[model samples]
Target chain A: MERRSKITPILLLAPAILIFVFIFVAPFIYLIFQSFWHYETSYVSKQVFTLENYIKLFSDPYYWRIYWRTFRLSVISTLITMILAYPISRMISRMPPGKKGLVTTLIALPMIGGGMIQAMGWMTMMMPYGAINGILLSLGIIKEKMTFLGTETGILIGLVQSFIPLMSLPLIASLGAIDPTLEDASKSLGASPLRTFFEIILPLSIPGAVSGMVLTFMANLTMYVTPSILGQGKIQVFGSFVYQQAISVGNWPFSSAFSLFFLLIMGVTAFLSSWITKSIQKSIYKGNEA
Target chain B: MKKFSMFLLLFVLLCVASTVIASPAEAADCNWDEATCEILDGADFGGRTMVVGVWGGTIEEIYRKYIIPEIEAHNGKVEMLLGGTSDRVAKVYAERENPTMDIAYTNMFESAKGIKEGVFEVPSADAVPAYADLYDVAKIDAYGMSFAALGIAYKPEAFEGEPDWPDLWKPEYKGKIAMSTFPGSDSEGFLTIAGYLAGGDDTTPDLAFPKLAELKPIPLFFANLDELFMMMDKGDVVAAAVFDSYTRTYIEQGANVKFSYPKTPGAIVTMDTLCIVNNAPNRDMAIAWAQMSLSPIVQEAFAREIYFGPTNSKLVLDEEAASKVIYGEEQANSLIRMSTYMTDHRDEIVERFNREIAED
Candidate 1:
């Protein structure tokens, strides 16, 4: 009976498992194989195995510079998103259920739109004489025109705008789970409002904040449209490099290698983030126990 | 006296009637009816769909106005697949065996590469009657559909006079000059011109980047025409490297930009090409499409509407249209064309361009 039950569950998930293998696993395996193969031309790639793609990539400092840029930008976006999303998440979490649902929907509205359109919107707004500058200039905020297109600040603005909701969702979950009376109890012990937050709310919300940060960080790291449009090709990031190699230069082997390497980096980042979140939560509980 | 006046009036009426009674095809010198267009007339397509891939905007508009109607008149449906050159080229190559795209519009760069790889059909007059009438430059790996020269698109207010190649290097214009992104016809042509400025040719690409680096702190690396034009309007970009056809089109549309031919070497030749994918779905329809594309009437529309130089040697534009487009064999031949040398060293050149020009 026990064996039959286990078999039935596997049978129920068989189609989904097959689909995952075909769409994700099978192509991924082929991509790995192709990464090692020698590139003859844009269309024709040789089957023989070679580590030339990896070796060539590692040899160039340009590729590493691009990787560092992507990493650096993503880290900055994540930190900013965390700071901005916390209060909004806390406010939303403490709201009445009816208003909460409505506000949350409105907050997540940008997520429903495609990245291309969003980036294009930002591109228009950040032009040398675009709306942002136009407004500022008319208001006598600046004497000279400020350039936003082809700058890191422009790309950062776009990343943070898109990611705040992602950060807020996770934060709302963890912050909501904290008991209201815990804050009151802390306050009853002669704790200041800020002290109550640090001793009670902030520590409890770390798990959610960490989850949000990781999500935002991963998103910003892999972002293509925002940087490609805002950076205007001046700022070289991993996404731009991959696109230029695969599409423009048509060096698929090298591009495949570049992508796989970044995939490894992404995996390590997620793992570290997860480990840090767990460790912080454990230490907080240990302090409580003591 | 009354009878004489009546006879004169009758004679004048007869002359007017004869002029009005003449065949519509006979009325125009450049007719596309049976007399001049026997190749496309009364063609039976059996209601099948012919898929054509071309860049959207004015180019696709020209095809729709001139070509699509001719096909539809003979029971053929043309589905327009509009996108960038790379995406279309990728499709034609990936589906070479059984291509859904009957006619794919490509640039000179990828068309040559596709033809070399046997992914595209070779150009021949046997399939398209008008092919025989194309200029020498148009007789290549595929049909050279249109030609334009790479030149400077400048704002008049920012320059002292009509600007040339050397004028771009003036100290005042340092950070305001915009360049097209690398690995494209515009950028490659610019590189070749830089090489020329450096006392070498396309054969010596190493000399090009160093000379180009002098124009650093470039404000914009424009791939989109609207973006470049907007910057020019805003007075942020004074001059930009662009093709004549686009500049002319924008000028007509009231954009604050002017097209100038450089004096040092000359404007670089950029050609838009058309190719039939190997084993394309609609072979007969594809042939018909090519014939219509190269016809004099269609070529005239392209010159008038979109400022592309007609590839057909038979196309003689009127004085006004001729002034707007590249007309006459001498002018066509005069446009400087860089060799396959630039395309051959694409990856290296793009890398160098990225390191030097694209980066701050």
Candidate 2:
């Protein structure tokens, strides 16, 4: 009976283990190996072992600048998404019974159809003298045409629009999970609506905010098609850089190294966010215990 | 009950296995060759199958109107393996060890790179009899194949007159001009154009840097032809460097785009060539297609419909089509043939461009 039980678990676990090894672990190991090798020019060119790729990456200011720019863009994009998502999420969470469905449908609308169509719509709307430009000009808000699609501002706009959904879902869940009586009690205790938000709601929603931030941040970091298309190759994000290295240069080894490097950065950010969220939770609960 | 389910599964498996085993044998049954075409007057492949990897879009119509009909006449089918240039190249490269294509088309630089990497075999000219009539320019055998040039394109409405290479550097056209991010010779051509105008000697791009830097804050740097076309269509850009085939099509489509040969010898020329994969699936079919592609009739058809200049000099086309094409020895000699220097200095020039020109 004991042996049969042990075998059952192994059988069930086999598929998961196989998938993990095949999809994630194998590629990662290959990436690490390739990073240390260079392409040899001989027939079936031998991969020469070298630390030069890493050394070159370390020495180049150009690559470092690209990395810094990518980090700044990711953080800025995530922050904007969070700021926009927070209120909408709270409002939706507070929506009376049946209206919840409508709010969700509205939020989920962008995700329902293909991304390409959504991207195309944004392209037409965001171009110089495009719909946004025309409307702004007619409203006498701006005189000169705004260069949106090719600029960092345009990239931010696209990133924020695409990632609002990722942020909103978690925030909505966290906000929904909050007991409304806490807010009610704060307001009842002579606190203003704003004060209640700061005192009760904001502190309670730390977990979701952290989750949303991490999700949006990672999405922004690994972003590819949208930025490449909208930026018109003007903007060089990390994902696009990896793509160029792998395909254009056929430097698979360098691309692999770069991908691992990006993954590490993303992992650190995720860990930091999680740690901060946990610390905030501990402190808030500790005060409750007192 | 368990046994019944297991038997049912086995039965289904057997059916799938049989189909998989049989499909390829069926596909290969149809003979694709010149002999088949000749004996049948080249009309026998109507119901047979032939697959080619191509850059899709409006360019697909070239196949739809011309190549398909010819293939269909011979009882043949042509499947399009479509994507961007990089995507298609990666796919073909991955399948280099065991190619899935009978014929493949890619840009000239890509084809050259592929040849150097041993992703493709040097084409057999004997198989392709029409290869004899190709322009001397096409004969430049870096990648073991011929290439077509993408002469300069401009907005006729925007320019008061036909502006040559130097006119791009003129104060009037400053900031109004757009150029694609040319990784190699294309950039060299632009730099050279500015250099020659500035009266600098030596093919080194150092002399051209200052003049190019003068056109500060180049509003856009397009990644692809489609993006460039979109910019031109909206009048966001005026005169820009582009391929003749692409510009010609746009002009025909009622766009305000016009193309001209920049008078300063050779302004810039891009070559799009043909190649056979290193490990093609149907070797017999591939060699046959390469030969067939070089036919004067096919070359003329490629020119008239696709607007790509035929390598075959004897291939006559309509006057309008012929006028746009730059073929022949005199034109070839006049043009500055791109070299390894252009490729090697790419990073430095682009870096300078980004720092000096883009920052503004």
Candidate 3:
């Protein structure tokens, strides 16, 4: 009977495995293969196997810096999203079920809306003589026009706005599942509001926070359109750099090498996040046993 | 119970397989091509469908009104794959081995780039009869079709003075200027403008960057002509480097924009060209469509209605439209032709421009 059940589960997973092979696994293998090869000048020339592309990528500062920049941007953006997400998620968790949908819709609107439209709207609002500057100028907050698009500040703002929802959704679900009695008990035990939040709510929500961070980091790392549109191609992210090498320079081997490097960085980040979350969970379980 | 679970698992797999098998057939329903044209006395197109890649908007409108209808009259079908110049070229390159689009219209530089990359197939004179009628400038198959220059398009109310390419870089006009967003193709015009502004030695990035860097205060860079015009409509920007046809169309749409040829020596010229994929699935239909599109009648119709000059010399324009375009023998001689030497240096120029000039 147990054997039959095991066979059924394997059968159930067959379609998923098939999909993974056809879409993700095959492409991943192809990308890894292409990374160690050299492309001739011709559009469809046979690829020559070599590790020169990776060697050059690693040796060059321009390509090397992008990996660090991508990592930094992803970490920074993820941190910002988490900081913003916690408060919003907390407020949503406290809300009555009836009003939750309205608030949820408002928060979810940006997520579901066209990214291109949001990007354009953000550019118009953030650019020099745009809404932000226009208001600041009128109010005498600044003497000179500020350039937003193509600046670091602009890219950060674009990344944050694009990713806030990703961080918040998981956080809301996790926060909502917390027992109300835990907070009330902490309050009764003479812990201050801030202390209660730190000792109770924050600790319980670690899993959700970790997941949100991983998601936001991945999204920001792979982000292409927002940064490209707002940064005016001046800001170089790994994704955009890979894209430029592939599309503009027509260097497929170099591009493939960059892509593999990007995937590796993203994989490391994801692994670290899960490891941290798991350790935290283990500690919490040990405390419960005590 | 295990038997039931096994059955359920099998059912799920069958469901997924069914969904996958059904999607493609459903997609083909809306975009059907008639095997035979009713307009051409029921002569069949031998089950051939010509996939055309071209620019959208006004060009798209003209194709529907004149070009496609004309082709359909001869029992041929044309499916217009609309996108920007670089995107169209990229698509052709991506599908090099198994080309989907039979005919594509792109800018001259991109066509040249594609030709060098072996993405486009060279056409014979027999395939394009209108080649003889094209002016000497357009006759060169650098990539695809003839070239057009980027001249000054301005609002007289906003500027109140005649402006040349150098005027675009004036510190006074900083934060008041707008340019197109895609720099890869438009960088040539910018370089030519930079060359003239820095005194005709644009080959050096040293001279070009300082002169072009003054325009760093430009408030906006638009992705398309429509966005640039929309900004102009709101009196945000005074002038820009744009083509003849776009300027004319904007004027027709009641945007108070003036089109002028800057008398600056070596003012920037751009080209628009058409190309066929090397191994097109429907070569006969593609060639026929190309001949039809570049034909005198079609080119004349494009000029009169859509505002771009036809490459064919046989298509004589109405006086007003003819006066607007930078054509004829004297006009052709005055303009500088872009050489292969300039194209090879395109990457370095773009990188430098982005690093030095574009940085805030």
Give the candidate number with the greatest TM-score.
1
* lDDT tens per residue, model 1, A34-147: 899997776556889999999988999999998999999999999988999999999999998899889988889888897788889999999988899999999999998787
Task: Quote model 2's TM-score.
Answer: 0.83
lDDT of each: 0.85, 0.68, 0.71
Q: Candidate 2 on B233-268: residue-level lDDT in tens?
A: 777777776666667777877876778777775545
Clashes of 2: 11
Number of the candidate with higher lDDT, 1 or 2: 1
Off by over 4 Å in 3: A1-15, A39-46, A50-52, A280-290, B1-43, B46-49, B69-79, B142-147, B154-161, B166-179, B195-221, B225-240, B251-258, B342-349
Model 2: which docking level applies? incorrect
**Comparing 1 and 2 on TM-score, the stronger one:** 1
Task: Give the TM-scores of the predictions, in the order they appear.
Answer: 0.89, 0.83, 0.82
Misplaced by over 4 Å in model 1 are A1-8, A135-143, A177-190, B1-50, B69-79, B96-100
Candidate 1, which CAPRI tier?
Answer: acceptable
What's the ranking of the predictions by lDDT, best on top? Answer: 1, 3, 2
Write the number of the candidate with greater DockQ, choosing between 2 and 3: 2
TM-score of chain A of each: 0.96, 0.92, 0.92
| Superposed Cα deviation of residue B112, candidate 3 (Å) | 3.1
In candidate 2, what are the lDDT values of residues A171-281, reduced to their tens digit? 888999999899888788899998788667887887788888988898889888677667755677897777766664456666677787778888888888788879988
